[model samples]
Target: MRRAVIALVITAAGLVPLLRYHPNTTTTAIRATAGTAQTPSASSKAPSTSGTRTVTGSEVDTEFGPYQVQVTFNGSTITDVQIVEAPSDRRSQRIAESAAPTLRQEALRAQSAKIDTVSGATITSEAYAQSMQAAIDAS
Candidate 1:
């Protein structure tokens, strides 16, 4: 009975950090390693037909391995950018998590491919930027 109790305590202690851990720690670590700020060049622009449009596709050759992004645009401006697929590694996941908001905000506001990169995941940011640009390009 004593041994079982000790094992339970150890298991609970081990789980404490994992459950209460702040994801920001990973973001901080990634930022320390990968400097932020990415700007994508302007690709050729195409005319839009009408109404709101959504483009969905995946970019295979991304910095954080294979990633998929879905982009939504209204008229000529992007309204949303969502990460449909992300990396398996924990560090990469955190990077992806950090970049999503930046990607969406910049894409919607800028209405151009010149959105700034995420603080930690420059490559992942670039990949999202490029994929989003491709969506813009397609539209």
Candidate 2:
């Protein structure tokens, strides 16, 4: 009985830290802009001099952090996709760093945001796709 009681106490103690641990759940208030030139208004869409247009997507709030992207379009063709914002936390940073290239490649290949999510970075991938789609739509 005494051993069972001690084991129970230890288990409870182990669970205490798990219960106390809280991740960053607060959402940021960053907004996205659509334009090659920096503009104050979110609705403004400016075309670059080289006949390409860069459009920034709306910021997507995820459990990790805000995700956003900027897409450059040459007429109707997507020329580039750039991550404008992402989670800065160490774990998230690692995941983003590894996943970004694959995601970019997929987006470029698909010519849209309908790309598969990275295996371990589901949340970030979803957020990235949403932001990328928004940018594509804006452009």
Candidate 3:
């Protein structure tokens, strides 16, 4: 019984530190993903010509629901996107905001949905891709 009690105490002591040591995994992942997601590839060169264009598209049956996106294209490149509608939940909203940079970067790079999804935000990433596709189609 004494040996068992000592073992229990040691185990509990080990776990105390483990529990108290906060890794902040979520923040770390978000930061890493945010960093990788924004870097532009070499292929996404800016258009050489000067002209303004616009495109609009909508995505349905996403994890969130239907969303509409409008993109402004200059020459052959996508310049900006206007979010007409987004998911209703707070988490989804946050995800939507976070995903914008990733989506825009991809659009600048490959000009399509071929870009990678943001880590830990799969559903939100899909939503962003769909919306971006709509914008590309419109353009």
Candidate 4:
């Protein structure tokens, strides 16, 4: 009986941490009007002058962080895509850094916001697409 009671206590102690643990449920929302001027960044490419225009997308807030995109169009053809904002947290930053380049390539190839979501960066991908679409629509 005593052994069974000790085992129960041990199990109860193990379960306590689980009961107290809570996943992050916080989310924030940020919005930006389309057609805003591009925010300069080191990663941004030089703007093409011939028949080209740059448009900034609305910022999208996800559980990870805010995401925004800028797209450059050369006479209705998508020329380049840049991430204007992304999550700053370490895990999210790592995911964004790896995913952003692929996402940019997909957006350029697709010429729209209908690109496939990057593996392991689903949230960032969705937010990116949403913002990209907004920019395209504005342009």
* Alpha-carbon RMSD to native, per candidate: 9.2, 5.2, 11.9, 5.3
Q: Report the lDDT tens digits of candidate 4 across residue range 1-139.
A: 9999999999999999999986877654444434453453333344433477778888887876788888888877888988878878888888888999999999988989999999999988888898898777767
By lDDT rank, best first, the candidates go: 4, 2, 1, 3
The lDDT per prediction is 0.65, 0.76, 0.58, 0.80
Winner of 1 and 4 under lDDT: 4
> Where is the poorest 10-residue window by lDDT in model 3?
27-36
> Which of candidates 1 and 4 reaches a greater TM-score?
4
lDDT of 3 by residue, 11-123 (tens): 99999998997452232111111121222223323433346755555543454544555666676667776555666767667877787677667766876756688886676
Instruction: Assess candidate 2 and give its TM-score to the true structure.
Output: 0.70
Best by lDDT: 4
Question: Lowest-scoring 10 consecutive residues by lDDT in candidate 4?
Answer: 40-49
**Which pairs, if any, clash in model 1?**
38-117
lDDT of 1 by residue, 24-129 (tens): 3222111211222122213313456555766754453543455666776666667777887776878888888877887888877887667888777787877777
Q: lDDT, candidate 4, residue 56?
A: 81
CA lDDT of 80 in candidate 4? 95
lDDT of 3 at 69: 58
Query: Which of 1 and 2 is ahead in lDDT?
Result: 2
TM-score of each: 0.60, 0.70, 0.55, 0.69
Better of 1 and 3 by TM-score: 1
